[model samples]
Target: MWLSRACLRLLIGSDVSEHEEAPLIWLIAGEPSGDLIGARLIEALNQQTGTRFRIAGIGGEAMASAGLKSYFPIADIAVMGLIEVIPKIPRIKRRMRETIAQIREDKPAMVVSIDVPGFCYDVWKGLRGSEIPLIHYVAPTVWAWRPDRAKKFAQELDHLMTLLPFEPPYFERVGLDCAFVGHPVLEGGADKGEGQRFREQYGIPPEDNAICVLPGSRSGELKRLGEVFRQAATTVAEKYPDAVFVFPTVSYLRVQVTELTKNWPGRTVVISSISEKFDAMQACDVAMAASGTVSLELAMARVPHIVAYRMNAFTVQIVKLLHGWNQNFVNLVNILLGREVVPEFIQEKCRGDLIGAYICKLLEDPATCEEQMRSVDSALAMLYPPNGLPSDAAASFVVALLGAQNQTNFDKR
Candidate 1:
């Protein structure tokens, strides 16, 4: 996706040397998943405009690779859970100030903020009255919890770009300019894996007994599920001695995962590369994963999987108080399906014995595996939007906005 001066000439109808300044846009992504989406969006913008944008914001490795120099590490504000965020509040506030300061100094045409609503909301408030259009990618799940955020978001953000097909209506009902960009995973996200090659490279036997374990990307997730996942793997190994257990994680969390599995009682392997992680998902017979984006990935991969999630007790209480006990499914797949397409063990129910038994049944019984995978396939079918690629759609919106801004400036001149 390298940009050339020739392409720039064709796009802008002028030589790069003759141009005084390129359009600048600020993008902030507070999580690794958001970083991936932001990087893809940046690439889409570059491909559409022939590298006319100067990107500056907060993001991780992927956005950095996409040519954005983040003002600070995204990890500074990546914390989840109510109690977990308390200690980081001061630092988060400081970074928000620093980010607003940079935005004021740069005066970019627009600012796009990816998820992490708490941080992004504060940034929006900081930028209030500046007249910089603040566009938010990945709308909050108000249907699940904090439904009031939708109304507040309509007031704060100028535009909302959602990954889910059903999300636009919720924001639109509250008078927000919303677009349903297809989920990023649906657009060429499933072709990254080489399943057979991954099995051979990792010495995993080509059999129907391999399982993938994903504990999640958060430090709190590892702390909560580490031992339980290890014990579950042990149980699976006991039931099927030939069973292979694979765990894939990001590099930042590799050391924590490795330390968690150092004394594992069964045969297990932890892989850290992005390609290997996707390959493992494709290669596995069934996946036992934390309830998040990986569940959506497994659905996209058509891999049979079960999910589990646990949060701090205080945070759980807060959720119950805010959203109430009527909320059921935690996994995105199940929530989208409106049924238990995949079994979920959450909070106190997130136990190794129960999750292992379910895994064992799926591994031994082909019918069970087939049934679960079919449900996943059905739910995945609902995520596709009318547009072809979400990044392309999002980039088109940004480009049009930038062009309008240029026109306004020329008219003023």
Candidate 2:
């Protein structure tokens, strides 16, 4: 909150200097998904003010492409849940220390973190009571589970930028200044892909059942989901011999995903780049994806899809402890819809055959596919902000500290 006037006064005088350089912002993204968000936010920050930003922190290729000089590889903090994170605790702590030290030394204008709350919030907690105004993009899914974290996080955060329209209230109720800046998926260019071009490039027949396969971006995700998805794809191929499977994965994991799916009994294409990923999404008739952000992208693209996820047995138990035995939906589309608009197979029900059956149903039944699209359209409508792109809304929210304050701009957009 102090960053509003005091921090701005430190950089730009009250009259605003024409030649002064913009403030240095420290940004941290701990996964591929977060890397995308950070990259878009960086673009927004620079474009909204027509001033370049001095950036520092950690991210993957997307953020790097957007002019971020990452402190370390994004993979360093990609581990999830109790089972995956236990072995990397030492490395995580080391990285966190390095991050905190770098932030303190830089004395950046603001510290904004994208998702990856485990690492991002930890870094922020270390800087609590300091002058740096903390703004976190993409509110944690306390609404999904762990609702108590909403109040706990309010104590340390200066502001929170949420993607979901319903998320700001969770933190606002606890006394934190929170804003719903819209979902980045709205401006991610998912809906503009050329399906014909993608089909031509891959020589996929227009009549063939093309399925976009997203096994997730993290190493642990690829390891857990690869086998299950392969068997599932094989099942679909057995039923629809002309079906084509499109596997879109992170660049680092592309080769591994291709190798894993090589023997699946269909025409398989693995795509690495984001452009190709969106093109594949357009070309595909349906999708079988890991339970995460891609599910939201598929919904935005209006593709019929079923989501499936399998976590470490120990991690599954930990989630059960935190989430209780009632709510089971992990995919954001289903979670946002307040019902299973998309079929979900998670944990114990995450069998290859079961997922394959759902994929087959989505592929063959036009009614089922059309029905899902209708629901997807309804869900997508709620994600748009009042004006401009979601990132633009986020940009306006972020730069309010640098200029005259506008109370209506906080959440009205």
Candidate 3:
């Protein structure tokens, strides 16, 4: 009987007295997107449990605003690309150890690792024998790159929360407990963006052809794909001489993206506000985007678009050697449909002329644009869940875990 009470106390912390030590949940989020998701999760937890938690972790401004006292800067760990990460290896390892040390000292009731799989995996391994329940918020792309990682996660993580509906099966087949919370993208406020407002603000003539280009939000992504996109815009302008190019970037990257566009061939505009970015996307006739979550947003906006991407040459070589071109598509939309609903220009094939050619074709062919938009509708329908919000779904899982522990304590008494 005492054993169960002790276990419950340890699992939930000093929940009886708010003046006593408040319960803590340690979170680790490595990038911007993860930070956004983590912030929402914290809000959900507070709402569902009806108890304020002392949240601490490594995160960006969004999580901090949501009430996390981040122990360190998230940018220190928000690294990507295999070869690009080479120089930051030592720092990453040090931060991993620091994170592990903090988790040990804090002894959080639960440790939630969000999205930065490689760094999170190492931290998970470091806490191998600890009693703290390890919940990983985004499953690794085991279905895409390495199938073996699923078995390792099944053995390590106590629970896996996934964004995609089809993801649970991949992990569950390997004995991992999995839940498909709806994707965060679906929860984006549908009423926020106004395309006509953006066009009016910019004084873009109604007859002018506009193309929105999302190079990517990451600095590294901007560095690799910016020139390619710029070249493509020039090619696009050649076909439609009065074409206006819009580069909607995250605020931090706005100056850099703006500087890059200076060399562009025709009229260009750069916007940083997210709502304004979406508004610009809505206003454009067609978009050429670097493949990422933004591709999903463009689809939801009902825009006909082409997806393009470029990477460090060495990274491209490594990807080719390991995965090859086996996965028929890179754009999330095409991947979801299991076919090329949109044109994909990748690596050496991501030529400006070719990308421009596809954009022109899509603009000229109404049938093709209609067909792709229809696919977008089908993909979105598959993604939306019948129940509550994604954050609420994730919160329900955590709440259930807490409830089970509380019940165990009662049974022992």
Against the true structure, whose TM-score is highest? 3
RMSD per prediction, one decimal?
Answer: 3.9, 5.0, 4.6
Model 3, residue 183: displacement in angstroms?
A: 1.4
Q: Write the per-residue lDDT of candidate 3 for residues 228-306, one digit (tens) a residue.
A: 8888887788889889898888888988998998899889988898767778888888999888878888888888998
For each candidate, give its TM-score against the true structure. 0.87, 0.84, 0.88
Model 2: per-residue Cα lDDT over 64-131, one tens digit each: 99998888898988887678789999999999999998999998878888888888778988897677
Question: What digit string (tens of lDDT, one per residue) describes model 1 on residues 18-62?
Answer: 547776789999988899999999998888777876888899999
Off by over 4 Å in 1: 1-20, 79-88, 187-191, 262-265, 312-314, 404-413
Instruction: State the C-alpha lDDT per candidate.
Output: 0.82, 0.81, 0.81
Native-to-model Cα distance after best TM-score fit, residue 178 in candidate 2, in Å: 0.6
Residue 58, candidate 1: Cα error in Å is 2.8
Question: How much is 214 displaced in model 1, in angstroms?
Answer: 1.5
